[model samples]
Target: MAGISKSFFKAEPGQLVESDGELFKITHLMSISSVLAVNIKTNESVRLHVENLVPISPTEVTEKKYEERLHPDLALFSDDEWAEAQRRFQAIKPLLQNPIRTREDAETIATKHKIHPATLYKWLKLYQDAGHVSSLVPTKRGRKTGTKLLASEQEKIIESAIEDIYLSKQRHKPQDVIEEVLRRSRLAKIPPPHPNTVRNRLAVLSPANTLRRRGFKEAARNKYAPILGQFPGADYPFSVVQIDHTEADIILVDEAHRKPIGRPWLTLAIDVYSRMIAGIYITFEKPSATSVGMCLAQAICPKREYLAEVEVGGEWSVWGVMGTVHTDNAKEFRGTVLERACEEYFIDLQWRPVMLPHFGGHVERLMGTMANEIRKLPGTTFSNPTQRKGYDSEGMSALTIKEFERHIVEFIVNVYHQRVHSQIGMSPKQKWELGVLGDANSSGTGVMPIPADPLRIRLDFMPFFERSVQQYGIQIDGISYYDKVLDPYINAADPDNPKAKRSFLIRRDPRDISKVYFLDPVDQRYVPLPYRNIGYPAMSAWELREVQQTLKTQGMRNVDEHMIFEALDRMRVRIEEAKQKTKAARRQQTRIPLPKLPVVVFSKIHSPADKSMNQNERNFGMAEDDPFAQPIKPFDEISIIR
Candidate 1:
């Protein structure tokens, strides 16, 4: 399945494909990120994800190295086999549509086709996933259940040898395991199995299990995980989730100062199946791997705790591991950190095709809808300068970051999810329910699996780097992190090269760099490493960066860990001073501050007189009305049931 890689998922309208052995022609792309294909044999139309359709011509598939993508030859099917495939396709076609059918619908169709309702639905799923009519072909039954060519006693001997010799802390070689098995068989006076048969048994053992058992836990986590090649279509809930970033179209204010900071960047993920918002992360920081990771972690885990944290009342039910995360080929999205994290969770990460923006239509549409909602807020820039004409965007800026987050969550869970979508002919929440829980007309595919360890999932996606532990512990970006657990790996050398140090994986949340997680070699658990000198307060990576920049500007030739923390402390003092001055001035101003209708003011002081103005007066000059300073109550709290 060489060409059956991402190239095979390339689809266009009017292309011929085989589904359930029957031929079908792709009609057009659907709004829900799906494609419409009409069955050639029965003239029945069906909606399918592009992955569902297999290439009809043998020439379409090239040789591939991977074993997963199988390009079955449809030309070999006999006339009778093709007719039976057509019959199965027709029987299951109605169940493929949106607003999934009920048990009643399944029973009625099952009776007409002379098939069991359960069997009919199973066939529907097989065809849906493979997109080949061959999926419906009858299996040539031969072997009875639990039947094995070898005697049970011989099988037990082989299993024991594999467990003891192949899967051991000492890491025995394959040849060693086979020799041991043969020796044992001979001692029992039984015929020995072929070397390949023993090798085949070893191969059946899961790669992760084998690696972990052989004391290569790090390798098991990093190297042996599967990377899915094909992008499953947006045919089901969590099938394909798209994420993108945009600078929010409004100015936000600082909590204490009550003055505009700047527009924040919004990282949003939307499930293509039901047009539901899967996850969102908003920050003043530019788009980076951390933002992508945070957004994805939110999407994959439950949102109940998150909703409560944000103080939003409505339910956000769209959470799970998506089949494919479709994103643009930005540098952040292409990073190894994201790629490996997705792989560890069995997620297929697909990039949008070059020069095709339409491939990311769902997230783009959601962004637009969000922008429209943002326009109604107090400090909206309204998407353009023309729209903001005579409007006091900065002067009207009143909402703090927390307040703005509340509004966004309110809009997503309360307004957008509940509103009737024109394209889907139902609210996103309604469609999501139908897909997850099924309706009167169709059987529902249950919800996607929730992560067992939610915190671990979040930590897995955070920024990570590899560093060898030393006597002083690990130093990263001018911070020293240490814990007693690192003592075993201190100054550890690589097994392959004695002179080289072994680099251990360390992950840290950018939001708080006070500690870093060290991947312990002993138990393969993430050990928390706090600052060696814990007196320094916790600070963000962004704050550390700014302090480094300030030090360089002041002509500091050699900066160290202590210098960075000292600079951060000074910066924190400056922020506290600004907050105090703003609060004091508010007590004096009886009249509401006047609104300023402009973006941002960056100017040079022409004279010494201008420069001599106190910092308070300079900052307070840009302040707006007290009413604008108050927290915004944009919408009423709306609670939703699951």
Candidate 2:
């Protein structure tokens, strides 16, 4: 009797052990270790040198019972079984003849007939729900088919449905699953649950009553698990954290604004390890340190605690001190005053290595995710101004640019940090918690802090320059800068010379730091300069380009001799016009008032319904001077139809 079960479904796990019945045919079997369990079925852990291994069902307690109801041909019940079924049906004819109108009536009749009334009632419900009107209807059915399930059961069903649909699953409808469960339970003489109960459970599970896919393809993902770790920031509420600039959109006046308030560059910061945003500030401008300062102030500066998790009167901080601050070589980040502040806090200034910009790639990715996630919140609006300004780091309000940011941070601290990450089956918060558990506190080797200098912070930011066609030396802020090594360029222009004209793009190097190099064409050679000490100095290429464009537009330069001749000729013409105007003025005497213009009126003139106007004629033009205008004589107007 091994490897045999499922003739009747045993609902309770323990009950399955007692039912010694067999149903499914193992036609496709070689040697089954375990049904649906890949690991045990493969037997990979312990390799056996046996020529044959047999699959034996040691415990026949499974709910996934199969049926031969599936058919390639319209097969029916066998001759004897059908004949016996007909005989049993005829024997039970009187119960059908006098239909019991109520459960009580059925029970009374059932007691007399020695039949289980509950069984008869269930069959009736099953028949009714399936449009058969028999006695097997589930217990949870009446008017509300889908709404009969309990809340927890509803949620479970919805979640299960979503997962199944995502896999393009078939075979089990909610009703079908319910019917099978009932069949199994009743087969073992256990009371079956109602269809309404199952339906109600599904309703509480999801009101939408539909399945949606998260749209991730496991096959396309890299064949490696995600590497996960943590980088802890401050400990107090928001004591000190690094603010990185990014842009995100959100809804404001909705219809008036059409889409969300866009062009709003999002400035936000996160606690390194918890991945929580300390604060956020958004504006319609280039992201700056000042904005970063504002966002940080909102986060670090304690205003109030609406509902305190910890005690009051203390600085609101989940992150307490600024540590080895990490950032790219952005100008806003490189300010000397900001560096001074960091120094005061004893925070180390760590500029991610040039060219290796993605060293701070985690923050960059976080910023991207912030934008994407908040974009879903775009149709959401706030009730007040401060929230819109992104000034308040925390408060109770409908989601605003600011409120949404806070929500984002909370999600990070609560959900993202707590759950096992998709990449690594460990949380960022868990990692940090582990680190802290490793060491309660440090000695004199305190956590690293940033450098703070108020006047102007000095950050070793990446720098480069763009190639220039020297027009009387590159002038920056009206002070002329000379590439005095013009001789090198001249010498290289001669075909006989072995040097490529050393033209270079003088822009901030997205990579490389310390020195500026005037690299030659094709980079055959480079003229390095000790720019930090001396040699070359000019504003950023972005600034210089703006100035240069302004000067060009204002006509600061022209073809010298050609403009001079043109100017002389223009001056003579101006003199002649002045004399003519003077003469005309001398002869002028009286003034006359201007005449008024005739008013224009646009009034609709509906034509008589001879269907005079074609749809094109009605919409195409005005009364006069219309290109598509056709002259219709009063004598001839006709109507046509197809």
Candidate 3:
């Protein structure tokens, strides 16, 4: 086994790479997406996709230590040797930024610089392979030529000046460093090194080391640290996805009143391999299982109908249950509800390694990018108080949650997905398509399998309660739901306990209790059960609680379903009346809290083996008693706009 630096994926010519248990020498980098390599033993040439290459770990290599070779001491070269190296660096510098694609291109550059094309290619190979100027220093055959033989005192003086003056918190200028070295040399009664020598030494100091010594350790790590090799397992699209939450840096207005409400939290999922936005969940609600469920559900399902509803003219093709859902160790991600649901769906749920934030680098970086985009909006809070100082974020609030969501989707589909990603050297959508469909150089894994029962998958992630069905239907948190679908289990007794009622599985989307789901015991399929009375206005669990508390304050003791609906109507009227008079009312009424969960009342059933449920035909229709201002759209056209 041999270890390879992750940078080898860039596939510079002259670099050795291993694929499929044989070694190949990269001859040319054709483009970001393609490479040309020749077998070392057989001399047979083959093309490859950059993505098909694996990062070679240094620990596995026994023949050579690549790290030591890549980083050599600049002091080893004499003045003339360093100058020749500098000349070679200057000749190839332009090509580093605008790389030559073929031998003809290299020949053109060689002719312009008056160097033979073969010599230019050799210089390019060494520089690109090591990514340093020192790699260009000509190797000496015998005793090193032009080697600087300085006395111990003079050498110590130069070293001290570089470390203490040039690379200190004060960040002294290069001229200041030269002067310090000269002054020290004068005091010690020693000959001083040339100014060019001092400058060359400064240039050879590792950029990361220089930055760290100058008080920019974090920036150094961000710019220079090895990232791809550190976190593994994201081998292809949908192999590993990172999901996380952050408060959006923009104020939002209420849909109805159009007044400043507050900032909303955004839960985002990004596929690490492609850096594509797998799914997004934005709401006024705090981060909870509800948010995670909605985000994951969106990630695993198609988005054609959703795009139509949002009126965004673009395709968001990334979907399907990911191989693993990676998230931080937050309590919301660790809840039993989420764990159980992922387990049932065969999705691997992994937590970030304890105390290691870099494990979540993908999602965190995506959040930063989204934040940067959001800060440009009119009502942006701008990330911090200093950035927001003198700015009127609340007063400038214009977009409602729905409007903001539309903007985010448009940005993701049109702008972000189309831009070239620095690390992958291609757009996210391009990477995603390549991973799915493949190309001439490699084979794709194919698109992931779409979940057959979207609604059941959603329900599994939502909060659940085990309650025994009764004649009046199911009651949850004092709200009752009824339908003929639950008749089999009505007053059903537990087989294990003859004296006690059998508890059945019931789940609800807290945002809307107008309907709840019943996991029928006999058939193992979920049944949608609307409210027992059916006339209640669709309201969130928060609003329901507010109504319940208001009734209690007004001296009403036993609240019924009818009383709740009647109170809701009055509350809406009061909200409308007060909205114009006070900002608090407008804020309270900011969001209607439309069901964030999918409209899957008519969706198909879960068919995992041994999953028992009653054999009754699933009644896939809005309850006859339920009232609606408009007809509920057929399930096929249903879309979760958020």
Candidate 4:
């Protein structure tokens, strides 16, 4: 006992210890008092002398013991019998530590521990041979084979049934698959598997594999395939720009009449590196090559007084030639004009692979965020009709185009740009500055400058048409344009063939039909050509088409310039009537207006016909007129009636 005690170490708190042939867990160690506070097997608390305590190993305390001496078959033993066996083994543990050379020696040690000599010798031999306490634990006493249904032939049948019947588009049940397996097994003269066994086997199949087997390739890919890699980000501002177009969820009214015009399409460009919006264009026109061109033009050109015009107070400052433009495979993005425009500016154009939306996720996400903001506005259609159910979007729409544009500008500058972006961990404005300057307080001397020849770039992106200069003027889509700039090219012969009439490349802004740009081949300069009927009001391509359709509906022939203008006038009257009738328009009239800078009006030399026309004709003649223009009221003296 003394020898054993000398070899044994002090037991710590929470250690399993043996005292008086009973297992006790040391709850606390009172080193000062040389006593251990212990919980007995029955969970009774008691204090014991530290000298009497011997630490028991976790394996000895927890592991079940068996009756079999060598590789004991523990399966036959009940829980009480196993526990008794473990106690017996623990009793003989101290004696086994000393070597027993003979049967007499084993008998002496067994007598001291109160165990049979034969049993003692057997346990000693077993412990010596295995050299591990776990080896003393007996396994279950039976053939350790798993279910007989897992045989190769049975497994093959089960797998075949699962593939053919269970994992299918029809979504066959597990019981049906089991039945199919049983039927197949019966035909082959093999014993049928239990239904539960078949179900367990089928349950092991992965969800992705099941989906794939059911002909859901996309679902399988989404569930099991690795996520798409992050976009190879740009190092500097404008190194990569992503552009996309989305229809705004909110309905907007015309600036003049304040009647619901419908949802406007917005083309937006975002700088990939800084996550800053480079430019945006909002219009009622559908997304086309012309829209893309207009967006790109705005993106590259330096923003002048646009912020002021929109009543926004921050410096937008984002502008420059993009090194690379990334976009999805939209018709507008794939147009030759867009390609040529990019090529002219040495910009690399990349189209994302089909169905891989993650490539252009930055711009797409920006558009989504913008749409969510728009959904909070007064007249949002809420992305889809399901979400817009019970909401009167058209009736609630109270924002004019100019007002909406201002709100968007304000949101971009004051809200979106200033908010800390989750991905970048900084505001877009800060990121833009960091990307441009590399350090806080540093000037943006390294920023890429805007193109020197902005007009040339603009002309390259504008929608163009090939027309010959006739004796009267160049007729474009039923409208004739004339300018002194076209005089040099008038009746000009083709350089290649003298007899053939020369065709000139004419560029026009869809937003304004009052003027067109004629590319002069001789000097390579664009010549601005005004409409032949200068009095004809500037109209968008969409408005012009609408008026043309209206005329066609009315069965009106001779769709001349005068008739077109008259149709526009009639449409204006209808729009005004709609404004007066609409509850939304009346609500808009009551909202307090924001303070704006005085609009700068540029003097224009009116044509003879424009001078002779009324004030309404002059108001809508140019596309550049103040969008927030108000009708002038005639002055009258105040009368005091008695």
Residue-level lDDT of model 3, residues 1-642, one tens digit each, is: 111111112345665666787677778766444568988679999996553444343443455443322332233245567667767877876676574367777778899999998888789898765544667888857645444456668778878999889889999999998999999999988899889878867876768889999999989977865343244478788888889999999998877777887889999999999999988888787798889988998787656556665667777877666768888878888876786556434467877766888888989999999999999898999988998999999889899888999899999999999999988999999998888767899876654544333454466567888888889998987778888877877888876455679888777777767877776655455667877876666787778888899999999988877787789889878988988776667766743444323323343444443134233223123333111112334343221212
**Residue 223, candidate 4: C-alpha displacement in angstroms:** 32
Candidate achieving the largest lDDT? 3
**Clashes (N, CA, C under 3 Å) per candidate:** 12, 80, 9, 0
Model 4, residue 282: distance off in Å is 1.0
Q: Per-residue CA lDDT of candidate 2, range 127-220, in tens?
A: 3222211112122434322322333444454445434532233524666656655555555565555666555444444221233222233422
Give the lDDT of residue 642 in candidate 2.
14
Global lDDT scores for all candidate models? 0.71, 0.37, 0.72, 0.67
Per-residue alpha-carbon lDDT of model 1 for 437-533, expressed as tens digits?
Answer: 6768886555444443355567767777879889999999978988888888889997545677988878787776777777665544566787899
Instruction: Rank by TM-score, highest first.
Output: 3, 1, 4, 2
At residue 311, what lDDT does model 2 achieve?
18
Once fitted onto the true fold, the runs of candidate 2 whose alpha carbons sit more than 4 angstroms away are 1-243, 249-260, 273-279, 298-317, 379-403, 422-425, 436-642
Candidate 4 structure quality by residue, lDDT tens digits, 90-170:
545666645446667667778887878887767756544443233334344653213232566888898899988988888
User: Which candidate has the top score in TM-score?
Assistant: 3
Supply the global lDDT for candidate 3: 0.72
Better of 3 and 4 by lDDT: 3
